[model samples]
Target: MQIKHQVVTRTPLGGFTLVEVLASVALISIVAAYFVHIQIQQVQERVVEALAQDVLTLANASMTYFSQTNEWPDQENGDCDDLIATLGGLGAFPVAVGGYQGPDGITLATRCEDTGDLGRTLLISVNFPFGADDQAQMLMSYLPTSVNEDVDDDEGPVVTHYVATPRRASERYRFYRIALEERGIFRLSKPDCPGRRNDPAHILLPQAICMPASAQGLGGYFFDEIDDDDDYWELQLLVADGEENNNVSDFMEFSGIPTCDGNRVYVGAITYCETR
Candidate 1:
């Protein structure tokens, strides 16, 4: 037997290499980061949706109050918190609106009051406060039809109802607004009309001399861009059907230039065109 002593060899129990361990750690980190991003996005979406629902609730409440009392809850003026108090005092406020903890820097303003010939309309607005750029943009993008941004003066529900947003110093925050009222009929009047040129168009077009037909106790008038063209002599007017808040558009027609006394129009003065 020639020295039957076998050489003993030792091997490490752990089989993983250092590089492999590091790669595994990096992969885990990437997956965790991805999940976190997803969670954040979901949270943001929920926040925006909640805010939109709350705004709708407030808007509906305002419409309800107008129909019931024939007035808007704008006694508080441009102060959202104050306006909320006013609404609450009149028992016209909504009981709850999502997670609305109060105005919280939001602004509630009344723009273009008494729009259209339909006197004393309630054109309420909900404004986003300064520094809420991300939130406001999100809302505008999400609800394009309902949201308005960077609207010039005399451009909204009515011509004079400028949609300028509030700003502070040189740091003008992104402007965001929601008109509680939709674009209403423009009160058109012809030159040398009977009343003062309080027409909204006058704000931008200084030479505009039209006045609201309602000022003369007349029905609303639809604007006809070209009165000379018989094809476009249709008069669209909003008339209430003896029912509260039930206004249906009444279309009338005239062949030639209607006089200030309203010849073939809705039996009301036509102040939108120059008489022949």
Candidate 2:
């Protein structure tokens, strides 16, 4: 018998060559690049969605605050700083409908009536990348969700703003009023709207329907806004009647509050306030 020693050798587990390794890496890089592109697109989409929602949220908050205190939120309060508390922070808006951009462009220009108790004015405007421009609609009913009840001091009869319906290149405006139960009691409940369910009226003051037209001062009303704190206003389409004809004519169109097509847009605004 003879003892035999066998020589052992190891072969690499993978049969792949250098070329195969390089090809595999190229494929992986392609896949990775595609994934990165998708991520970027998603981020941009989310930003836009957030902005739209922000517009609606602020609008409703202003409306609700108006209903409770009968006064618009103070433009000077920490809660009232445009774009700072928001993504746009003044520039948050693409365009200034009621806000300012100045010669360069003013965003959110507020006017205080000198009376002190009268409260400061607020004006904001934005443009969707696509939508009808400067059209008119009325806010027959609304639901806003924020306010500061601690601050009280009845300045005037109610909270007022201007909205303008469509008219010639110029000359269109309407007055909008938000009547509050009291000037400093923020109500968490679904607004007092005493007659909304059946009476079929604006929640604020009784009667005094918001209509559309452009005339002189006083009884003559229209829809228009050259700048923040501009004069006049118009009617927002009523969810009940056909005044609005919304058809993608409002800021809330994407939010689904109310439309001529019978949809809802979370967005709301003060389009018309009665003259008296």
Candidate 1, run of 10 with poorest lDDT: 200-209
- The C-alpha TM-scores of every prediction are 0.42, 0.26
Regions of candidate 1 where Cα sits further than 4 Å from its true position: 75-82, 94-132, 151-276
The regions of model 2 sitting more than 4 angstroms off are: 1-14, 68-71, 75-276
lDDT of 1 by residue, 24-73 (tens): 99999999999999997787667767666655555566656544433345
**What lDDT tens digits, residue by residue, belong to model 2 across residues 199-262?**
1112222223232332432232122222232222222322212233344332111112222234
- lDDT score at residue 63, model 1, on the 0-100 scale: 56
